[model samples]
Target chain A: MYVRAHTWWTILRIALEERLVYRGDFALGTLMRFLPIITQIFLWWAIFESIGSGSVETAEIANFTFPDMVAYYLLTMVGRAFSSMPGLASGVARQIRDGEIKKFLIQPVDMVGFLMLNRIAHKLAYYSVAILPFALVFYLCRGYFTAGWPDPLTLAAFVSSLILGFLLGFFLETSIGLIGFWFLEVSSLLFVYMLFSFFLSGHMFPLDLLPEPWNLLVDLLPLKYMAYFPAAVFLGKVSQDELMLQLGIQVAWIVFFIFLSRYLWKRGVSRYSGFGG
Target chain B: MSEQQPVLVRVFLTFARNSLVREMTFRTNFFIQCVSAISWTLMNLGFYLIIFHHLNRKPLADGSGWQQNEFFVFLATTWIVFSIVQAFFMPNVQEFSELIRTGNLDFVFLKPIDTQFLISFAKVDWSALANFVMGILLLTVGVWRLTTQSNNPLSLNLANVLLYWFYVACGVTILYSLMISLAATSIWLGRNQSLYDFWFYITNFSRYPMEIYARSWGWSLWGLFTFVIPILIVINVPARILARPLRPEGPWLGLPLSGFAILATLVCLVISRRVFSLALQSYRSASS
Candidate 1:
């Protein structure tokens, strides 16, 4: 068991080193990603300006004041930084299709475990480089967080939700990737997944702005746990009791995806054939 | 020069035909792409619908003259212009960095055709045009509603229609110019993986009405995007011409925006051509 743990540590350390080599690209890319927030600021300001009849300071839409909305968007950016698994799904599918999974079949390394460790390393590397840009952006937009920092308990809840959100994002995407065993081409499926994920995850707009039936439907889905829930927690939008319940639900979803991905992997490996020598 | 024009047209047609054949080879994938594209359009429309509902179906409070139907027209224009760019130029520009890194660009230089023309028209992504069809449907509905429901119904005339299309072409040209210019940077940067992200960020500004960026704090951004980068006018000018044609607003910033749009297109094309040429001149083939 100690030897197995060391091997995993080595895997993570190597992955982190590899990611650090592209630190420059990650830094610039993170900074570029924030450019759209400028547009959002102007857009929401205009919307609230119209709604408030020139008194933009106190106008509320869908229970979000202008500052609150901006703050919500900013916090969602943080949540997304933790949760987004870009290229992971497609990369997995590619490996499975290209017969690269053979290494894992013959080797002692478990593919899902290895991938999870690699992703954790990637997040660590990404955040190390991205923290500066994120801090600069948050500091610049500090005024928007009108309620200021949350209490310690709420802050702890926010942190826990973000970590759980990361796990849920990973397992859910890994399960989608594992579908490669059944379908040779999963790019189109991934495209469909991305389309729904972007909207339902509240990346485009707050799910609260969604009307009845739609909002209720989205609330039931696990997608919100990836983006909207953590941001909501940080903003203190959830009551104390609700936060606990929501956190529990998030854990359940993560567990569900963990099982689903492992099941897919086991079945897929049994059917896997190393066609080309 | 005139003889070369016909040859270039033939080459472009061949490229499009080849792309269609390639797409047909994966009919299921093509169909799924179309479905996904249309789904995205519907979701985007739904987002705006919710916003309009929240606003009580009124014009933007910023005095942008963009009511629900008019904003729909703007959104449709964005889709149309973006679809054309995505279908034709986006794939080619994205591959440009790979060509540079792998030194396959040397073969491109060896071709008898204009290097710029060859590089720009080598591939077409037919799946992206799915948004074009969706855009036209939305545009027709938006126009029909505008004509029927408005206190002053739109006067759709031949001249206005022609002008709208002309400006749409200009919008496509401007975007293509920006894309090719950015792609040219791959020659210097070796592998500009961030090209798409940068392009998306820059164009995100053009997706909304120009009036949204008219606040005191927004003036600098407004000026930069309007005059410096010129992305703001790409969708706004065409959408405004079609959606609010009868309005007597002379021009924005006291300049004739429509005329300026044509001028900007010419400027952009010339500048992109220059940039592409300079990058090619500086390019050291992979062998070197």
Candidate 2:
């Protein structure tokens, strides 16, 4: 317990220091995240107008009305905030292959902790640069504030769901980065992850937008929980019952990926004959 | 000059062959990238389906001629065109900027023939090519859907289609020029990938259904991209050519638009040449 506590703080410290130095490309990445949101917002706006001035009852088709839809997208700006992308994962995996892990293995700091923290640093840098302007534009363009429940319990739900969303993403990305141990190539793995995340997380559209059976299937998938769940929290769209259920799902996924990542790392180390071996 | 031409051709052949062999060695990667590209394209198309499906029961721009199917066709075609530009020129522009950042131009400068051509064409990753092929396939699917709804099938009018193909080629050229200019900024900044990404980010504009984002400020923003950047024109103009004809507003001011696109290409080529020379001036040995 003591060593684990030490490891967590040590990771946070390193992450904080790294976050202080901003890379120009980090700014690029932040701005890049906005492009899809821009397109999505416009796409939705056009559809809403064509829907002939709120003809459909908001409560009937799905949980979201026009204003609710806007908020859902805005919340999605940071929905998977704690997740690491395959780009960074591939870089770490390369280090593992080049046997750079040997130097780190000798260090007292936790290995996976270092990788996750580094990503958190970059994610912080990315969001700080990109999210605010986007949020302002989204709200102003939609001509409304997003609906929210002001209850303390709702806040707690949002906080836990958001943090869990990040953890789930981090563990999944790290576990996949673990593939570098077994395979010479990690790029393919990363590419596959992007595709899965896009479809499963409901990034392209709301989870309910997908037709019925697929919609139910996606909800069962962990991707929907990471991005769609938190966005639903912001919009006050999910039922309290659904919220508890999805949060449970998110926790399960994080546990699954954590174990998967640990197994892969142990197997990888057996091959890591150390630097200059 | 005659003696040097063969050497240039030989170098090009050798570079192309080796890169192909290197890429072929990773067949699994090629499949993954192909699937990934197709999935992202489909995901966006799926979003389009949702919007139009909802709108199908609704009204139009002025609440007239607002068929959901026609708009999807427009989106699919432009996306295919955009994917093509993305696959080909995006790589060249990305590589050029990186070359400046690492001061890696010394090797290219030491080589024979035009350094610009050499630097630009040396690398071709299929991530871009795969996106183009998949995007075109998706666009073709859109066309098939549109055919079921239209009077004149595109298959019957092959000639005009071929003429429009020339403009598509020109559109590709315009895209390449605009990127080369943005990439030229790297010579001064050491790493101007942010600038290239900023331009690529602007491509998000092209994904919207037409006349939807044409609100005054937004439309003109699109117009500025048409002139200064030219990426928007690559998608929108070529798409406009294929889908429709010269408007009574006289090609919707596209004649001057084409002229401006050509002039921008000239300016881009000159600026990149001047910057490339300056970057070479800063080049130092790796030991330093």
Candidate 3:
């Protein structure tokens, strides 16, 4: 167990260094990415004005003000910053397709263990550089957070949810990549998964605002934990007990996905063919 | 060069046909690609549907008196413009870095063809045309709903339809120019991994109505994106002409700006062409 732990630590350290090598490019890219929020901010402003923003009683949309909506969108960006594993799945699929999986077979590495450790390293490296841009942008738009900061407990829950969200994302994506073992290509499947996740994960809007059946159905899914629930927790939407319950649910889903990925990897390796010898 | 126009046309058709054939080899993959594009468009449609449902057709102040259907028209125009670019230029521009890395550009230079034209048109993503179909469908439905649902619908005339298509063409040209110039930068950068990221940043500004950005806070964005990049005029002009004509606030600017957009598109194309040539000149082959 100690040897195993040491091996994974080495992998994480190397991955972290590799990511830091492109620190400038990563930071610039992260900053450029927030540009889309400008359109969202404007669109919500128009919506709120059109619906009448005179007062809480007079406004047509009662639940969400323009500032609230903007804050939600910006906070969702933070959630995505934690949860999005940009090219992990596709990278895995490509490696499998090109017979590059042979390296793991020849070496003393476990696929999922190596991938999870590498992703942890990647996240650490990302947050190191990315926090600057995110902080700068969020500071500029600080006025949107009309509700102000959350209570201490809620803040802690929000941070915990983000960390778990990253784990869930990595496992879910790597499981999807494991499909490449049976299929010649997985890009199409990955595309479908991405499209569904983009909507159902509440990246587009608050899931509560979605229609009845959809809201209920999306609540049952694990995706919202990655985006909506964390932001909602910070907004004080979820109660203290509910926050604990949701975090438990989030951990349960992560465990289930991790096991699923391991099961798939085991089954895949039994029939694997490395063509290049 | 004038005498070679027919040959160029023939070569383009051939390239497109070969690309289709190659893509068809992976039948399921091709089908999945189309389905994927359509699904995202549908999701966007659903998202706006819900937002508009919340609005209940009230006119937005910053939306320039736009209601549900008028905004749908704008959204449809965005998809159409984006799909045209995706079909024609996206795949080629995406592969520019790969061409440079693998030294395949040597073969491109040796061909008896205009390097820019050949590189841009050599690959056609036929599945991306699915979004074009979806866009047209949405636009037709939005226009129909606007005429029927609104109390004072904009006049739908032959002039508007023709002008709408003209502006769409101009919009596409401007977008294509922007993409080609960005792709050219890969020669200097060796590999621009964030090309898609930057592309989204630039294009996101054009997705909404220009009116939203005419405010005090958005004036800089308006000036920067409208006159400098000229992306705002791309979708806004066509959607405006067709969806809700001139709305009195900027009637003179509306008609005159479409003309300027055409001039802008031409200027952008010329500039991007020059940039591509300059980049090509500076490119050292892999042997170096």
Candidate 4:
């Protein structure tokens, strides 16, 4: 068991090294991804200036002050950085379609385990390189963080939510990829999934700002855990009791997704046909 | 040039036919792709509906902000322009690097045709037309609501409507220039897979009202995007022509900006053409 654990450790180490090979490009990409925040900031400023009576204190749209709105946007970016899986689903689907996945079946490796470790390595590398950009951007927007840092307990909850968000994102994407067992082409499905996630995950705007029926319905979905909940926790928008309850719900969703993915993989493997073999 | 125009038309028609045939080979895939595009359009519409609902009571300080119907018109214009780019140019530009990688571009060069024209119109993404249709539908609804519901109904003259479409054409041209130039960089960079990511970043600027970027600090951004990239005028000018033909902010601003947008389109096309030529000169065939 110790030896097996060590083998996985080596795999993770190698994957981390591989990611570092493209560190420069990755870092630049991360910074470039934040460019949209320029427009967001401008748009919000305009909105508040128009709606509110000159000062931010007067502009309370859906209980979000201008500073709170700005803070929420920045925090959501952090949450998204943790949870957004860029190419995992399409990469897995391509591997499955091309029959490269058969190598995992024959080798002494589980595909999902291997992928998960690689993804963990990727995150480790990403966060290490991405921290500088996040720092710089946040520093530029420090004035917006009027409420300052959360307390230790809330901070801890925020961190936990981010980590869980990552796991949930991974499993969700993996399950989508596993659908490649039945369908050779999953790109369209993946595109549709991405669209839903972009809107539903609160990446566009705060979920609370959305009107009724939508606000209530989107809350039930797991996507809010990826972006909205973590930021909400950080801003003290969610109370301790609600945070705990939401965290519990998040864990439930993650566990449910994991089991569903495992079941799909098992069923898929039985039907999976290696093209040449 | 006039005689060759019909030949160009024939070539484009043939290309469109071949593309359609290729797409039709997998009918289920084509249907799925269409559904996927439509779903994204619906989600975006829904999202904007929520936002506009929140801002229902609050107009801009100078009445420059797009209200529910006006903003929907802007959104529809965005979709139309984006759809045209995706359908006519994006798929081709995306494949340019692959063509270089696989050495298929050598054959493209050998053909008796304008390589840029051929490369730009090679593949037609028919599924993207789903969003184009959706955009028109939304535009009609938005315009109807704008005329009927708003206290101050905007005038929509035939000349302005014609100019709106002309500006939309200009927008498409500018996007094509930008994309082709970006794709040409693949010759030097060798497999630049982040083209789409970079494209999204730049185009996201055009998604909202140009007036938002006219604030104090936004002046520099306005200059950069207007003169440097010219993406600011792409969707905004056309949308404004339809939704509010008479600019409440400044009357003279729209005419001069529209003229500049047309000039900018021409300048972008020439610059992109030059860039593509230079990049092609630097290209080493894959076999070599």
> How accurate locally is residue B244 in candidate 2, as Cα lDDT from 0 to 100?
46
Look at candidate 1 and give me any clashing residue pairs. none
Tens digit per residue, CA lDDT, model 1, B1-288:
987888888889999999999999999889888888789889989988988888875566456668889888999999999999999999899888889999989999898889988889899999999999999999999989988874878877888789889999999999999999999999998888878988999999999988889898799998999899999999999998889833555345234788889999999999999999999998988865
Top-down lDDT ranking: 1, 4, 3, 2
What is the DockQ ranking, best to worst?
Answer: 1, 3, 4, 2
The TM-score of candidate 1 is 0.95
In terms of docking quality, how is candidate 3 classified? medium
- TM-score comparison, 1 vs 4, better candidate: 1
Candidate 3 vs candidate 4: which has greater lDDT?
4
TM-score of each: 0.95, 0.80, 0.92, 0.93
Q: What is the lDDT of residue B163 in candidate 3?
A: 85
Model 3 lDDT tens row, B95-133: 877898777899899998999998899899999999999
The DockQ figures for the candidates are 0.71, 0.42, 0.62, 0.57
Residue-by-residue lDDT tens digits, candidate 2, B1-288: 677888777776777677668778998776666677677777767766665565554532323233554455456566566666665466677777766656566677787568777876675665656766665665566556655645543342675466456656766665565566566667666677467557757666655434455554556656666655555555555555454422222434357765665566566557657765665566553422
Q: Compose the digit string of candidate 2's lDDT tens values, residues A165-184.
A: 87888888787777888785
TM-score ranking from best candidate downward: 1, 4, 3, 2
- List model 4 lDDT by residue over A1-277, tens digit each: 9988998999999999999998888889889988988888888877876676455467767878878888998999999888988899898999998889999989898899999999999999999999999999999999898888889999999999999999999999999999988887888788877887888888888888887778888878998988998998998999878888999999999999999899989999998877687
Candidate 1 per-residue C-alpha lDDT over A1-277 given as tens digits, one digit per residue, 9 for 90 to 100: 9999999999999999999997887798888889999999988888888888666886788989999889989999999998889998898999999999899998989999999999999999999999999999999999999999999999999999999989999999999999998896688889888888899998888888998889989978999988899988998889999999999999999999999999999999899887886
Per-residue CA lDDT of model 4 for B1-288, tens digit only, reads: 788899999999999999999999998889888888888789878876765666665643325747777888888999999999999888899889899888889999999999988899989999898899999999999888877764777767789789889999999999889999999999998788899999999988888787777778898998899899999889988998888834464652556888898899999999999999999999989865
Residue ranges of candidate 3 with Cα displaced over 4 Å: A53-62, A91-109, A269-276, B1-4, B60-63, B245-253
Fraction of native Cα contacts reproduced by each candidate: 0.73, 0.55, 0.80, 0.57
Candidate closer to the true structure by DockQ (higher is better), 2 or 3: 3
Error of 2 at B102 (Å): 3.6
